[model samples]
Target: MTRTVFFISDSTGITAETLGSSLLSQFEQQKFEHVIVPYVDSIEKAQAAVEKIDRVAKESGEQPIIFDTLVNADIRAVIATSSGFIIDVLAHFLGQLETALGQKPSSTVGRVKNADRDARYKNRIDAVNFALDNDDGARINRYDQAQVILIGVSRSGKTPTCLYLALQTGVFVANYPLTEEDLEERRLPRPLAEYRDRLYGLTIEPERLSAIRSERRPNSPYASLRRCEDEVRDAEALFSRFGIPYIDTTHASVEEIATRILVETGLRGQRSQ
Candidate 1:
């Protein structure tokens, strides 16, 4: 049977339209014919739209699904209709509104709760996108507040590890490269030096490092085995001199590296995700 869905919203009609379009895209018409009507922007429009939907449902013998965002009288009348199912999404919105109001106004408690939730969600999407953008483990760091910072030479699996930590564990993970310049200077990057205790360095065998780089920049000096070995040794020596903790990422998967780093850094509880 063909299914018709309606999205009615008093406010954020664009949001309703966008979400409706996204939900519809998940379906293929060959298997299920579907329709999404968005932006029932007012009580009058919502009631009129319900009448139209009811007529279509009766004619087609199809039970329509109505996702309603109207929080006023029209929603009540529409819910009275018999030919379709009206889901009062506005009820949930109202519940959330009440919750927001019930908390103490102008308080850090309310602000921090909202801020942390927003940050967590934004971080997860960023992690997934970062994984896609830096698929080959290019040296990069974006999540600056990651509880567990990942330090590694180029192609030592730092990007994938940070992404996995962020996406799966919701742990903010910043990563930095132990570049030849930093190694030559016998110091960690200036930014990372401040968080010396939280830094978790990753090292890999020269041969594997060379192979991974060659795939990205073949025959270039950056991909040479000699450079890889030199950087690895220099980085390792610097870590030792600075007494910074480190990990060998030679055969570790993203999960393993993240887990080990969290565990060794005493951040198993401090960093989640």
Candidate 2:
């Protein structure tokens, strides 16, 4: 049976949805139809949300499950009148926190809108821009400013991993695509030699690499299995020669690759504030 699930919030419903989904994941046999109601800061919006929840309950003949992060007491009261199984996310924890801290909660909308949060957001944006600017070894001179530099053959998951580290962790990430010349020479690029300690390598299985390249350049020598095998073999050998930490991107997601890089390099605690 499919149950109606509501994720309501005064700001973006990210918090509500994240917590709600995590809880729902434990019920492996249940299916849920999710409805997100964000920006419910005012009484009118909250009342409208309640009406929607009631309508869904009436239509489905089952009480809807509500996961809420409503900060305003009036808005919360209005939503509580709906015919749903209410789960007050903030109310469950705020009282304990208030008692522990001996102070009332701020109860503000979009808590991350302060000046310090704005500065941190700006830093993340700048890191994203840096990743894009230095992609595929475009701006080699700026390697001095990079926190980590990813090196890999084409389509080995370097670009996406760099972007993930920059956007999610606010780390200054740069990527350098190893070309035929660099692979044949079996040495790191001149521009990256000084940053050897910060270098990370990505290698992919030849079959997967060939399949990925075939989608871009079909039936070409560059996409041939022979070329793919040679390139990957040479790239891994070069990484070993230089003692650069590397991972095979054969099956790892971008998040996993970025997380592994951070954990292995001890950069997880160095994220931008």
For all candidates, what are the clash counts? 6, 0
lDDT of 2 by residue, 128-232 (tens): 999999999999999999999999889999999988898878899999988889989878889999999999999999999999999999999989999999999
Write candidate 1's Cα lDDT for 1-273 as tens digits: 567776656543444444454555687662333344444445566667767778878887877766654545544575456477776654666578779888523312112356776777786776565555533324345434456667778888877787777676566566677677878888767777677877777899999999999999999999999999999999888878878788888886666777787777766432321
User: Which candidate has the top score in lDDT?
Assistant: 2
Clashes of 2: 0
lDDT of 1: 0.67
- Residue ranges of candidate 2 with Cα displaced over 4 Å: 1-6, 19-36, 50-66, 81-96, 268-273
Q: Between which residue pairs do clashes occur in model 1?
A: 146-172, 165-273, 169-272, 169-273, 170-273, 171-273
* Model 2 score (lDDT): 0.90
Instruction: Provide the lDDT at 169 for model 1.
Output: 58
Deviation in angstroms for 134 in model 2? 0.7
Which 10-residue span in candidate 1 carries the lowest summed lDDT?
103-112
TM-score, every prediction:
0.49, 0.79
